[model samples]
Target: MANNTSSSRTDAGALVRYYLLRAVVAAAWVAAAFAIGVANPVAAGILLVLYPAWDAFANARDAQANGGVRANIPQALNTAVSAAVALGVLAALRIDPRLVLVLFGVWAVLAGLLQLAIGVRRWRTYGAQWAMVLSGAQSALAGGFFIKSAAAPAMPAIAVVAPYAAFGAFYFLVSAILLAVTTRRRGATA
Candidate 1:
């Protein structure tokens, strides 16, 4: 009974922290995007890169927790690839922001699909399956929008940085809150 209770508390803690991280990261990226301006594709790319890094650690941790095995191999691999692509886009931003954005959009779409595939198929083990699905869908849609925006060279002067900064901000905020709540729950149970 004691062990079970402890395990439950542990799981709750992980859940809360996960959500808090997501919220914070999202909000920060959105803010960065808005502040940096659309022309500053490098900044935007940097912001996007953060997500994959964060996810890599999170996935690795999760894999360890589940069975000391790299269970989320696909997620980890996809995040790595996404990060690399984002970096490559950033490197080319000086030449053309539009090009960077287009690449970013492509990366986002692929990452979203990969995440959705993993989440849908392996959701039975996770408590926040919907959140994963939602995140994946959002990524796909946002990627598409970015691609379209790049295609429309005559479109309004919107800041590309806004999306990234705002996303990071939101991600961090939500993640922090979730972590706090989980901490409290864990404490109570403990």
Candidate 2:
């Protein structure tokens, strides 16, 4: 029993570290988007394309670490979807932010739903997934907003996606903290 608890605590600690790293990366991306990527078209274009691609990489890494991609089907699917979106964004750049936003919207909705499923699945092992669940729901809603904005005649800028990134960072940070606290508490009781 004690060994089981210890294993769980160890797993939760790894999760906490992963979440924190994700949060930091997302936060840095947000900072770069606002500070440097927004003003320069080239920088903006690179940031736009990189976001989904990075998500693909992150999803694959996480899935592989937790289990094989086959075991984590949602994340595996998310990896493929995100990779496609990165390519889509690259293509859309030649057209306009309208197409870019549309692609982003579609990716967000699909990825968010997958994330929600992953969070639910991980709850049994990870114990503190509330923030991740909430983040997934919010991401879906934000995707809708992006889709709506894209339909407008006036083109939106890359700045539009930054909020979603910021929120993602916040949620990851919260999840990391929650996991750390929960794991420590469980460890004490055990």
TM-score of each: 0.67, 0.95
Error of 2 at 145 (Å): 0.6
Query: Candidate 2 lDDT, tens digit per residue, 78-189?
Result: 9999999999999998987688898999988998999899888887787789999999988888888888888883533468898899999999999999989988888777
Compared with the true structure, model 1 gives a TM-score of: 0.67
lDDT of each: 0.59, 0.88
Model 1: residues with Cα > 4 Å off, grouped in runs: 1-5, 36-69, 154-158, 164-190
**lDDT score of residue 129 within candidate 1:** 56
Best by TM-score: 2
Cα distance off (Å), candidate 2, residue 18: 1.0
Clashing pairs for predicted structure model 2, backbone only: none
Off by over 4 Å in 2: 153-156
Q: CA RMSD for every model?
A: 4.4, 1.3
